[model samples]
Target: MTTAPTPSRADALIREHRENMTISSWASDAVDELGRLQAAERTLQRLGYQDRGGQEWAPPIGQAPDFDLIDSLRSRIAELEASKNARIHKLEMQALDLASENSILKRQEQAELEVRKPLPLPLPLSDDDRLRLRSDVARAIWDVMREHEDRCGHALEDVEPKHQVWDCADAAIRAMKDKP
Candidate 1:
C-alpha cells in the first residue's frame, strides 16, 4: 500500500504559467556561474601578468630560478586563459540552445491558453423571426433528404416524417452550435 500524495497550491499556477520559468531559471543560473568563473580567471590572469619584465632572486645557476618561475607562471596563465575561452564558448552555445527552447515553449504556452473571445452576443430572435427560421430549417432538411433519396438512392438516416418538427429542431440546433 502507498500513501496518497498531498495536493499543493502550485497546481493552479502551473496550469496558467506552465513550467516556462524553470527553463529561464536554469539559463540564469548557467549565465551567473559562467560570470563568476570568468571573473576569477581575469583576476588570476592579471596577477600572473604583473610578474612579467621583472628580474628577481640573485642566483649563480645556468638558468636563473626567477626566469623559470616566470616561464611557469606564463604557462599557467596561458592554460587558464584557454580554459576560460573554452568555457565561455560552451556558455554561448548553451545560451543559444536555451533561447531556442524558450521560444518553442512560449509558442506552446500560447496555444495552451484557451483565450475565448466573447462571441457577438447572439441577436435576439423575435417570435416572427423564430417561426420563419423554424420553417426554413424544416423545408431545407426536407429538400435535402428528398434529394438524397432520389439521387443517392438512400433514405435520410432518420427521416420517417413522423417527427418532422422535432427533426427540424434537431437540425437547427446542430447547424447553430458553437464554432471553434
Candidate 2:
C-alpha cells in the first residue's frame, strides 16, 4: 500500500483548530510562519503603510495594506505564544519537583542500606597487656583508699582489695572485646 503524503502547514493549522489536537512538526512550522508574518506586519505598521487620506504611503498608488486584519493576526499570535510559554514553564517546574523527589528517595535508600550493614569486629589484647591493665587498676584503687584514710584521720582495713581490682580489670577488658 502507498503511504499518504504529509499535510501542508496551512492544512495542519486548520486540522488542529477543528479537531483540537496538535501535529507536532507541522503545527510548529505553521506557528513559525505566523511569527514571521506578525514581525513583518509590525515593521510595516511602524513605517507608516498608509497616509491620513487612506492613500498608499509609498509610490505604489493603489495598494494600501489592511491594518485591521494585520492587527487581529498579531493579537492572536501573541496569545498563542503566551500560552505556549506558560505550558513550557509548568512542565519545567514539574520536572524539577520529580528530580527532587528522586534525590530524596535515593538518600533514604542509602540510609536503609547503612542501617542493614554489619558491625565491625573488635581487636584482641595479649596476655602481657591484660596483666598490665590489672596492675594499673590495683594501683588506682590503692591510691584512692590511702587518700580516703588520710581525709578521715584513720587507716582503713584492706579487705580483699586485690580481688576487687582484678575483677574490675577483667570486666573492663571483656567490655572492650565485646564492643562493635
Candidate 3:
C-alpha cells in the first residue's frame, strides 16, 4: 500500500523564525540610524551649526591654509624688533652723552694742567732753598694721600709712595694758599 506524505511542522516553524529574525534585524538597523542622527545633531549643536537653523555645517578640512598662527608670530616678531630698536636707540643716546662728557673732562684737565705749570728748576740752589723745596714736596705728598683717603677710602699703604708724593705735596700747597 502507498504511504501518505508525512505532515512536517519543521517548514512552518522555520518560516516563522525567519520572519521574526528579519523584523529584529530591521529594528536594530533603525535604532542604529536614529542613534547616528542624534549624534550628528549634537555635534552640529556644539559647532554652533544648530544656531544657524539646523543647517548642515561643513568645515574645510585640509583644504585651505591657516594664516592665524603665522599672523600671530609676525605680530610678536614685530613687537620684539620694535623693542630691540628702542633699546638700541636709548643706548646710542647714552653713548653720545658719555662721549661729550669725556671730551669736556679732557679739556678741563688740559686747561688746569696748563694753568698750574710747575716752578722751573734752577742750575744750582742754596741748601736753604733745597730744604724748603723738600719740605714742600713732603707736604704735597701728604695732601694727596689725604685727598685719596677721603675720596676712595683708601689708605696711604694702598698707593705707591713715589706716585702719590707729588700729588700730596701739590694738594698741601693748594690747601695752604686757600686758607687765606
Candidate 4:
C-alpha cells in the first residue's frame, strides 16, 4: 500500500540536501568571520584608530608624541641646508673676487714687461755721424760745465765723472734736439 519514489527523484532530493548543507556551512563561516572582524575593529578603535569623516579607517597615533621631535628635526635640517647654501654662495663670491684680482695682477705684470721692453731706433747712424754726434755732445757738455762753473764759482769736475757724464749727456742731447 506504500509507493516507492523513482531513483531519479531520490538522487535529485539527495542533491538538494547536499546543496542546502553547503549553503549552511558557508553561512556559518561568514558569521564567524563577521564576529572576528567586529572584535578587531573594536580593538583598533580602543588603540586610537578612527574612521575620519566616515571614510576609510585612519591609522592610530602611537603612544608616544614623536611628531614634535620629527617637526623640530625637519626645521633644523632646513636651517642647516640654508646655512650650507649661504656658505656655498660666499665661497663662490670669494672665488670670483680672486679670479678678478688674478686678472688685474696679470695685466699689471704685462704692463711692467711692456715698460721694460726695449724700443727700436727709428734710423741707423753711420760711423762718421756717430763721431760728429759725440763731438757735439762733448762741446755741449763743456759749455754746460763752463756755465755751471761761472754761475757757482766752483769747478764742475768736483762732481764724480760718472755722475757728471750722465747729467751732461742728457742736457747735450736735449740741446741737440732743440736745434733746427
Model 1 stretches with alpha carbons more than 4 Å out: 1-65, 114-180
Best by TM-score: 4
* Descending-lDDT candidate ranking: 4, 3, 2, 1
- Candidate 4 on 1-180: residue-level lDDT in tens? 978879999999999999999999999999999999889888767667886655578887657346679799999999999999999999999999999999999999999899644333224667776556655565556666777666355444464556665566656555545555
lDDT for every model? 0.65, 0.67, 0.71, 0.73
Show where candidate 4 strays beyond 4 Å. Answer: 1-65, 122-159, 163-180
Writing each residue's lDDT as its tens digit, candidate 3 over 1-180 gives 976544576677778899999999999999999999889888755554434455656554443444687789999999999999999999999999999999999999999898565666553768887657756667555565577666456544465657656555656555544554
Off by over 4 Å in 3: 1-63, 97-119, 126-132, 145-180
lDDT of 1 by residue, 5-88 (tens): 446555766655656787788899999999997786566454443323243322342532465788999999999999999999
Clashing pairs in 2: none
lDDT of 2 by residue, 1-180 (tens): 976646786688787686655466678889999999778666766655534444444433465667798899999999999999999999999999999999999999999899645334234546776667656555555567667665344322444555565566567556645766
User: How high a TM-score does candidate 2 get?
Assistant: 0.34
Residue-level lDDT for 152 in candidate 4: 59
Best by lDDT: 4
Error of 1 at 68 (Å): 0.9
